[model samples]
Target chain A: MGETVIALAGNPNVGKSTVFNGLTGMKQHTGNWAGKTVANASGHFKSGKRSYTLVDIPGTYSLTAHSPEEEIARNFICFDKPDGVVVVCDATCLERNMNLVLQTLEITENVVVCINLMDEAKKKGIDINLALISERLGVPVVGTHARKKKSLAALVDAIDGLPHGKEVCRTDYPREIEEAVKIIEKKIPEDCEVSRRWLALRLLDGDLSFKSEIFEREGKALNHLQIRRAVSEAKMYLDKSGIPAENVGKIIASRLVEKAHEICDGAVTGETGYYKTDRRIDKIMTGRITAFPVMLLMLAAIFWLTVKGANYPSQLLSDFLFGLQDDLSGILTKLNAPSWLHDCIVFGVYRVLAWVISVMLPPMAIFFPLFTLLEDSGFLPRIAYNLDRPFSLCNACGKQALTMCMGFGCNAVGVTGCRIIDSPRERLLAVLTNSLVPCNGKFPTLILLISIFFAGSLFSSLTSALILTAVIVMGVLATFFATKLLSETLLKGKSSSFILELPPYRRPQLAKTLVRSVFDRTLFVLGRAAAVAAPAGLVIWLAANITVGGATLLQHCSDFLDPFAKLMGLDGVILTAFILGFPANEIVLPIILMAYGAMGTLPDLGSTAEIGTALAANGWTKATAVCVILFSLMHFPCSTTLITVKKETGSLKYTLVAAILPTLMGIIACVIAAEVMRVTGFC
Target chain B: MNEYISLNQIKKGEAVTAVRVSGSSSTVRRLTDMGLVENSIIECVGRSPTGDPAAYLISGAVIAIRSADAQNIKVRRRENG
Candidate 1:
């Protein structure tokens, strides 16, 4: 099944992933390539009578590597020697994607040009003459709508069809470089399978990367005496032509662009001013006057939908799960299991697990799909583009806007999304501040506080939403503050080059997106929550049940922390709850209620009124409520996010900063809020 | 050459032919690879809300680049536009 590995390669946003998924379906494994952090996915699928494994390489704009992503992409095609490469190109913008395609073609003639998104191209009144492109590239070219399964028949046939390593239209360099190539082309080793002329071009380009990559791939350097002499002679000849060696890389790239321009002329027609519809929409989207309001409205609408939509599903899920708790206890009793064992599994682990799942699932289920739709519709980049100036002021870029938006769903996902930020400085800053934005897990807690203290039942529902939006704004502001603070002190650097491509907007595929978002984002986050929920549940159960001296362990810990918590205008129980709630924010209120002796067990407090009653009985005034909300908004990210930071940054130092930065800010904020309330006698 | 202004200096909706792009090796190389080479017709399609970065239509791709980097590219008014 692993035989005949074919590489699926393309530029970013070209729907290469769609083609890969259609070919591989669910039978795929994502693994690291050459120790790089980018996803390297490969899958096995059968075509007619043949079974082939396809590896989807990292999407790169060019084969001459700059970033790690580009490096992985170039190294794979140059060294991995897959049976064939299918370069997926967006039909609407074929010329831009051709750099990678043409580069792949130069490396090896075993290529199939997959012109994807044919439907989008037609909508733009663009026509592609497939035969002309096929003839020009001397490779089998197939056009298809990657989303529709039936349209892929020709593509699959091409994958199964090609052994045609016909002569390719080589990327012609300027006279100086061409003369250099001629000096060395015939000296290339015949046994080496890479195109000889391409090898000569790379050597003349002074590509040091290929030498090391060759050493790793072939276990030796290209030390052929004749080849070495020819390489030097080519360099000597190039020097005689008065072309500076420093400009060789740029010259080679410019020549490749020119060649791609030459190939696209006439073969693709009616492409001028193609994105008229998208341009009109983008005007309002990025319009100076309308941009910020539209962004905020879109955000609030998504949050509103998530909160309202999750209500019914969350109730049903919790009811079903809590119902199973009784059956589980009964089974334990029937088995004559020890009383302690039954209580540990039932009250301790099972209860917390059920609580986190019910609270986290419904909202994420609604939120992630909506977020994915925004991303799929291509509006998310506009958010980055519009916000770039603000972020650059913080020594970051607008890409962090994307990560911050994801933080609204889950901080861990946001932390992971920071990988897209190219600079290590900005990435770390983004990761460290991601938790400042309240995630969906904390939304329930924040809403409960707002409902009880700020937006009491006297206020309309809109007031509560406005208050909640204000809280999110505070978190976003806190993120910027922390980011600026870190940039000035810890991660000081000028911002890197910020380049974003806003792809043509297309209708999002609703069905596939729903299924994929549900599985990939919803379940993935839920799974991480459950991982810590089980263990943290046991510890919280132990703290509540195991008595130290007279009171329970939970009570003693709360009493000890009461003085410090008082400085922040919160009681000890509130602070202790936050500490324990490091696993999942949803259970924080329940733990506080349990510690307050308001309920004998962790009651999934049925309503905001119920939770409010418990807090009011425990002496939670407006100051306390404000502090608690602020803390939840700014506290250390949950255990799940910390682990992700540790994995992503692979540095304990950065992960520690990620955990401590927001917590320190939260503590400072609460302390100030509490003192102001006391001094002003606002209570 | 002095007659040509930097790309970032162009007004939105203006079209220019790139004379050359000069920057750090990485930036210039990447720009060229994305088809911002010599003589390529570049059009400033839209400016971001804050006006620090602008979207340019280069060879049919809408690329958003910050003004800091765009300042490195030299361009002149398109003769044929």
Candidate 2:
């Protein structure tokens, strides 16, 4: 026999995901806020002799299908026909969570109510009478602190004892609607797999613009002639009463909300006192006077930590990796491997792969965890809340700010995160402008340039970090500018409405978040960079080594791009390096160093000052460094982001637009900077 | 009779009971789904700097509703607060 399939359902911010992870032993990113798990995640777990397939449906407020996520949650519960459903509810706020619970009960009798976050509830001085509620709802209810595995044992036990015949205490609809529901239920086919009561509610519900969709989903079961006649008859009966036609959906919703609160009267008790602690923190974090400064300081602190924390580890890693190249070369020589093969393998592929890992790993390891910490603590939603007004001024949804934050990690991720924006036009706008702000992959190069030219020797790291923060601010402003431009011209539309939920600030699970984020985001991005870097290193090496007439192919290409590069206050070698860094941004600096090395005038690379001196010898000016930073900031996204864009939008045209928009911006910005420097005699 | 006011008109730290949520737009539907039904208590907890979206405490959750959508929701001040 197949495994017992159980659908895990709940309202937003209810720890439904936490429960899923506890049961399935899956690392389904438990970021505790609304809409994090938009796409359903399915995993398997075992209990005693029985195995269960658990589908974690998106957290939603209702089954009424007001949005895509809700629609998904609704359709899954109705049509999927799982063996049993485990509705996870937030114990601290069961009243709101019950809205989804009673609606689910209306559909299925095989429900095991898992009252999750018992710890949070207990902390809030809220108490729930689980046994009483279980009896009231005619379902087995288990209380659990989802983070504690022992607490989840009761939940697993309840899943094994899947309750049947839920004599659920649901609110009765008003008499007119009740009469209408009865008529519809009487006409619904008994052989129908769908619950008769649920189907009746849908059939009698007003203005179901997606009625055909539900009917189509149920495979014509509710589309029968008798059901239609009964529904219209019920509507006539509703009209005969004082209940207006349009008021049907509203009235039905009101009953459920009332019923949910009523059910909680004896079962759940205690006020969180308007979450006083969280409210106090929100006053400062999202306060009108302090919000922007707090935001900038938070961003700056994270970057400062990332920059400071990553330096030693990065240096050590590169030293170890690059130090091994000579041994590899010596081993190749002893094995009588061809010089070209040895150079390609040791000096080319191995060196690049090593550089990518050493450079990308530490910063990502530091940055992603801090970012995840913010995400876990509910601060990110507040950021979206605070920024919504400004973002809306661009004619884009404020959620774009969330996606932009994701972009600070990686543009590919930013593009995927664009899924949170509902409107196609705004999502497209986000996708197109995402690469304007550099990802962590671009940070190594940006930092190197800043330290060399902008930051004076004293407090260099601090100065560079602050300058990096300013550069990020520049990128953010550019994002707003570009979004506004596109919204006006290409992707014009009114901003779609989204309910921004500022979830109560829970203490972030610090240790757990750090460890999981390292595995989830840091290593994943590093793995991709390493994959791209090795092959790219080999290609760049070949381009530099392979001679064309008098000069190497690398030199020839640079010479060809030299004049245009100068127009941007950069030289040929820098331009060629940017072009070669197409596969991954991590290798751009290494490529520049390698090109300079080929000229035989570059010094051995180690310290920043020594490298700066080498750059000066190679005709690099402060203006050149500034231009390089500008170009790097605004240039086309890596090939990975482009492919992601293509896959996301399913349009080659937009993918090209994503690439061209930033590159054009970079060229214009660099040329203007270069011209201004020349005119001002600053170059 | 307690006078009805648009939700945004309620100042910060004020609590009100929802009388009726008008309109059939997706926003109103979302508001209803999130437990802004008639007689449900909503507290004005905070406001954005630009004064467009005001965050309300409803059903044990902080939900930010823009003034445009807040106008659809009619409420009366709660004496308790």
Q: Write the per-residue lDDT of candidate 1 for residues A128-243, one digit (tens) a residue.
A: 99999888888999998978878888888888876775787677778888888888887765677666778888777877777566545654435567777887888878778888
Q: Single out the weakest 10-residue window by summed lDDT for candidate 1 chain A.
A: A27-36
Error of 2 at A470 (Å): 1.0
Write out the backbone clash pairs for model 2: none
Provide the lDDT at A463 for model 1: 60
- The TM-score that candidate 2 achieves is 0.93
Fold similarity of candidate 2's chain A to the true chain A, as a TM-score = 0.92
| Candidates in order: C-alpha RMSD to true structure | 3.4, 2.7
Across A194-279, the per-residue lDDT of candidate 2 in tens digits comes to 88888888766653634766678766665567667887888888888877767788788888888887788888888843687988
Residues B1-81, candidate 2, lDDT per residue (tens digit)? 779899879999899998878854566667877878888889889987667678998888888877777887899988887
